[model samples]
Target chain A: MTQPQSRIRRSFGDLSERALAFWLLVPAALLLGLVALYPVGRLLYTSLFRRRLTDETGNSPVFVGFQNFVQAFSDERFWTALWNTLLIVLVTVPGALVVGLLLALLANLPFRVKWPIRLGLLLPWALPLVFAGLIFRWFFDSQYGVINDVIVRLGGERLLWVTTPELLFWAICLSIIWKSSSFVALILLAGLQVIPKELYESAAVDGANRWQSFWRITLPLLIPAILVAAIFRTITAFQTFDIPFAMQNGGSSFETLAMYVRTMSIENLNFGYGSALAVLMFLISFVVTLVYLRYVRGADD
Target chain B: MKKLFWLLVAVLLASTALAQQTRLRVFVGGQQRPDVMRKIFDLYQSRNPGVRVDVEVGGATSDQQQQYLTTVLASRDPSIDVILIDVIRPAQYLASRWADTIDKYLPAASRQELLRRYLPAYSQANVINGQLVALPAFADAMFLYYRADLLEKYGFKPPTTWDEAIQQAQTILQREGNPNLNGIGFIGAPAEGTVCTFLLPIWAAGGDVTNAQGQFSLTVEQAQRALQFWVGLMDQKVSPPNMAEKPQDTIRSEMQAGRWVFGTLFAYAWNRFQNDADSQVKGKIGVVPLPAFAGGRQASCLGGWQWTVSDFSRNKAQAHRLVRFLSSPEVSKILAIEASNLPVFPALYRDADILKVNPWFGQALPVVQAARARPQHPRYAEISEAIRVTTNQVLARQKTPEQGAREIVTRLQAIYGGR
Candidate 1:
């Protein structure tokens, strides 16, 4: 009995030492909670309440029980923004991924075009997004746009790229492609480098051609990296605002969810409704991340 | 050895403290021209020898506002001591108690001087709930710009009434033969610029988005007439079809290109039209007040920025001094000449030296005096956006004017519910 009691004492002491390490981490953990999670928590808290401009100034935060969210869901503008946001994501994510992959493939290839092309592919991402937006806007301008000017000079009709609602999406997509496809390429190139060359060598020994090897080996191996890149790209595309906002100035047809959140919050001063919309966006992106982790990461792992 | 090490450590710590003492971190929006901003800040630093003000300008207006306001609201010891604010937002800041009311610090004589010297409406706009929330930092207002040579060449006089203006535009369109040589270029974009520039014409024609009772002011017939007139400009091809997307600057540039004969523009446009190296029609452009709508009073827009102190500023006294100094008549005149901003102080507009520097002041000063402010509601930004969106929709042919106007009224009611 005494031997067992002594063993318990020693185990308790060991446990205390482990506990001391956790205690040391408490400050850092609390700091993360305060700095990172606190605003998110406040956003979530505000999302559930119904408040107005008056409520924001000195009125005690009241519990309205999902009314703000309900209003957000019912608001046609919210749905319109969601639709536009989804459309932007749908157009941009796959477009960026495919183009990025193609560029990365060309960049990864051993050719006379390799270094210059690689540098060029990386240039868009290197340049500031605002500059990229302005450049694309200038290119797509109806009258002064170099693109339109060239077209008109070549005896073609001028196209109002940012004005036409139908064209606004494509113009924004063009800029998104210009600014972000390079980021996608950079991410994929990093992934492509991590891929084992020996796998391709083995496939070559098995008599697989370049295309077959790429399809069968390189792509499969790169899936995890591709998934990571896709998830980030998707989140960014859904929150697409800067390019569209810069191009069209919070346009009627091109109001993305991110832009609407700002429009409602700052411009409209409906912080509660805006907060609710933002919370929904957060929940959506978080769920998307979780799903990606479960499906993509789990499959890879 | 221990004594020597302690002495070195103390010396290093002392230098670090000194470095930290003189640093002042500031934040501003990226909308300002970066080169000009750098020069301005460089001047600020040179003038204040001991203070090094570090500025971070964001790319977008909304992003800058959000980041700056969030920092000010949440910081235990306010991180940013200076902020550049949009004019429409001072009401919100004042109401939320995020901005300091500078009236207490400003001398009564200076405040009275501001009132007596500036356009009455613009001066009143700088006041919030009877407290001087901000001083007018820069002034902007729409002015009626007509082609001086064209009107004279065609033996036509500038119209003083809405009907006369429309007839003149129609007559010009009929006679010019060139589709590009329209009578007017209206900023029809579904943006804030559209609301500021185009709404002036509609409101001057006796149309309003909201009435004095703060209720929705657009009747279906009145809204239809406004839309008809706006689209009529396009039907006559006076405004380009692409105008639904064109920004204010684009129209200004086009006008400078002599493609359009007349357009409404901000007062600062005089600088761009006459002085821009790229301008072709320099010294040929003319400024006047927008013509009155049939039986309606003429109204231009009152748009400008105001200076305010941050509620959490550590140096409120210094900030107040800066505000007073900047708003002084002398500073206003200097800025008017240098920055090409419309002087908000009336005295500067009347000053002989200012008029000498800005010859167009003779025409533009009256426009500023006659300018109409958007609504007095703290939610004017919200109201403005709804008007912009709905107006854009109509101009884009997506919705009828009636539908768009009604929708806006509904949104306005929703926002201002039970107020």
Candidate 2:
């Protein structure tokens, strides 16, 4: 056993550092390629062709080059969906961050039983996206919805929360904020815990008020965590599907980019156009990620 | 220890026996009650002791089920041997080669006989490209539901035309003096039901969506007129202001709670209105053919489910047998009586037993006979989305009727032109 073990060690030692590193990375690189790179590569390839899954002729996909991309650019629904996705990201990311920060601060308060508040913060995060959407859909329902009921009870005229597009947009944003803020709060809470309570103590000794200390110390230190949360929220917001889809069932006026992809690929069986749309969505997300990474690097500097 | 050893040996023997038996999975949508389906499968299992039929229930709505099935079928998943699909999906399924043709399973005589036995609309939907793709599991069509007690109280007969219906609704709303009550309700949301809603008025006005050559034939004027009527309903308060948000279930629930004087819904609503515990419209609901345009005949949108064996199924022969058995006339009668699903066979529609359980089905037969299927195209889903989305815009007052009509024409022209 000892001789075999030493022989194995000697063989491994024969490998140079670079070769060892390459060998070490082979499994992870292959895994990443299989899980991530292959689907995206296939999507890129599919985007360049005209393929209909339901075509009765059994014809192979015809090479269409950039025609699908051109069609997407000219499609009015595509633009509307892109705008809706962007609007959702713009409205919901900051909304979640602000609300999440408040919740995180409250949960981090020196309370006797932190578990209840922590669990309260976790409940919305743990709820399924589709379930959250359905719950909010009911909440904003025009007739028997809780929102309308409360408004009527308060002597305010009942507003059509869902039927009206603008109202539905706001309602969706609010629901997304409610659903995602807990996750943001959890992340920020971790940052808060690592915050070194001694800094706040020193600030107090330096005659700093609670708000002053929070603004000067907590806010500055929390920036990295906030940026991380924002990046995640922004990416997810771009792929917003479940909430809006559950609320409106892919109504044209409120359709998101992801919903449009589903309508094209799955509903219409037009994989070519759907893939083009997906690639466009991916490019937008990639650019946004790059921007966020740059901002994170600048903050680190 | 010896007793334990004997028990283990017995368990192993039973496991081997079970493994030898064939297991088939049948996927049905939520609309088809799985419990009722399970009972039917149990009957099949009793006769074929070597086989086990397991029921898998899918999504609640047609669109949801379509999406789920599309993903599964596209991947050629063989786990599900049989599937229950919407009436509109047979063409798509056949074109995609997801559904196995029944021609090989049935002799020419039996196939023709089976086709002749089912309702014409369903027969037309199931047979595509001279191939029998599916068998009708049940029949459904849109019906105009009203409060029988209220119409009688007001000494009025059911209106047979749109104008008359609108006039009656106005008078009833004014007289009822109930703020909670609305005149009429139909699906105006951008859902699968909205496609039927959009086509109803056009079909009633004698406008065909597709020509005999299977080309897109809807005229801009026809579309405009249909939109105008629906928009007029919302503008004149015949329908609720938020009608654009109401799906079929919402409309059903509202009508069941006695909030709407008139509702456009499918055959299934009759069973719910009369039997559901929360139903306030029990014993007071009246079913009628949907109203037509003044110069045209009445038309209902044909709706139903069909059973098809998956082409990728490992147990193709057994799956085909199960489908045929499930769609047999005897099973149809049982479904009609027990679940209130309309029978696909015309003879069962007139069956004494079915009539005894579902009296309204007698009235529904004429409507079912006259009902029209939506445009039959492999890309019908795209066509449906274009029309429903445009109609929704008109109903929501986001677009004028002319704009909506023009949009529909443009979108449909592109879809047809692309092909």
Model 2: DockQ score: 0.62
lDDT of 1 by residue, B1-419 (tens): 99999999999998886776455555556644344445555666688765666776754544346544644553434656556666666676666666778877758887786567656775677687778787776677787788888788778788888667777777776877775676677767766666665466557667666677656665656655666677767766656766676667667888888887788777767778888898988888888787787777888887776667778877676666656655566656766776677777766776787788687776777777777777666666677677777777677776777787677667777667743
Query: lDDT tens digits, residues A72-132, model 2?
Result: 9999889999988989999999999999999999999999988999999999999999999
B148-196: candidate 2 lDDT, tens digit per residue: 8988888889989888889889989999999989998999888989989
Cα shift from native, residue B345, model 1 (Å): 4.8
Best by DockQ: 2
Task: Quantify all predictions' global Cα lDDT against the true fold.
Answer: 0.73, 0.90
Interface RMSD of each: 3.3, 2.0
Question: lDDT tens string, model 1, A230-255?
Answer: 88898778778778877765565568
Cα TM-score per model: 0.81, 0.93
TM-score of 1: 0.81
Candidate 2: where is the Cα deviation over 4 Å? A1-24, A56-59, A292-301, B1-20
Q: Pick the candidate with the highest TM-score.
A: 2
